[model samples]
Target: MKKIRIFIIDDHKLFVEGISSLLSDDPRFEIVGHALSGNELLSKFTELDLDIFLIDINMPEISGVELTRQIKKLNPKANILALTMYDDYSYVEKMIKSGAAGYVLKSANLSELSKAIEIVASGKKYFGEEIQEMVYNKISGKAAFDDKRPSMNELSLTKREIEILSLIVQEYTTQQIAEKLFISERTVETHRKNIFSKTKVKSAIGLSKFAFQHGIIDFK
Candidate 1:
């Protein structure tokens, strides 16, 4: 099998280093090159032939969205996958509309991220779970909701953790949520702690506020 050639465009040295380290040992992908900004990528774009691009939304001199547009203009068949920390629907929509084949959160596990690259390389769209939920909620406000629980719109939290966070926002006591979900309070407490750790919050109120600010959950 031919390895997918991937070029990364991001200004954060840690992000570039981390991704490179993660993929270097993988057999399915070949890291052809990397650039700290879209401008840098543009300068090196024509010099190397690559199949996929791992792009970040924010950069020093040009954004991944604009870069994706320019890339498509230059090579209409190029596959681009957005990798970022922002799970804001606006960012995802912007990247998608700008020509990214996939929009994945930086929080996604290695397997999920790799699968997105593979799908995009195969000429298919890969919208992360949070992205899909955001689209659904935007198009239909609370239409398919159950019991008025807000939809969790970011993969930064695992599915189970998101469920716990949603319940937390709904003011459900950890015990109540555990009982409702048919799990032990101990399990719920563990998930609650994990949610707090992942979200960097010390309390439920702070978590709710943080989620609201990031568009991870809506109050309506």
Candidate 2:
């Protein structure tokens, strides 16, 4: 079988090692490289011809969202999946915007993780059921499930830009947003500025409120 080359970036060494071991045992996946920070991931990303990257949303230096943006810039086909413990509606919306093909919580079992990878690798979205529910509830407004918000692309934002926009709404510090998105602080700031320019908003709060009001984040 042709194995999928995978890279992982997370701050937790124990969790990284454990996940590496699990994927190593799976014939469908080949663990190529692992890093503990977004900076490390960027520095070493080119060394490994990765087919997919599993990034933790919160990191020390660069954020998963930022990193995914960089990776997408370099290789648009790179499949980035965010593996996080946060299933909050904001996080989910932002991760999708950032260029991640899917979001799977760290609390998920290995089986679910594997399924997420396979599903995303196939060019389809994979959200945990709970996460899906959260998104649906937020978008449908009354949890009626009938009137759903449009797809993330409907905003005309690129994958990475979408991710950054979502993070902006979450009130993440620039440093924290950088680490979670895997970009530098300067880049995050630049993106923030660009978001303001594009959305014609003056402040982060404006963007957040606008996103909520326009059903950009659902809660419709």
Backbone clashes per model, in order? Answer: 0, 19
- The TM-score between candidate 2 and the true structure equals 0.62
lDDT score, candidate 2: 0.74
lDDT of 2 by residue, 166-199 (tens): 6666556899998887889999888778778777
Whole-model Cα lDDT of every candidate shown, in order: 0.76, 0.74
Deviation of model 2 at 97, angstroms: 1.3
Best by TM-score: 1
Model 2 misplaced regions, further than 4 Å: 142-220
- Tens digit of per-residue lDDT, candidate 1, span 73-166: 9998999999876767688889888899899776556777888999998999998776677678877874432222234543467878877776
The worst-scoring run of ten residues by lDDT in candidate 1 lies at 142-151
Task: Give the local distance difference test score of model 1.
Answer: 0.76
What does candidate 1 score in Cα RMSD to the true structure? 11.3
Off by over 4 Å in 1: 143-220
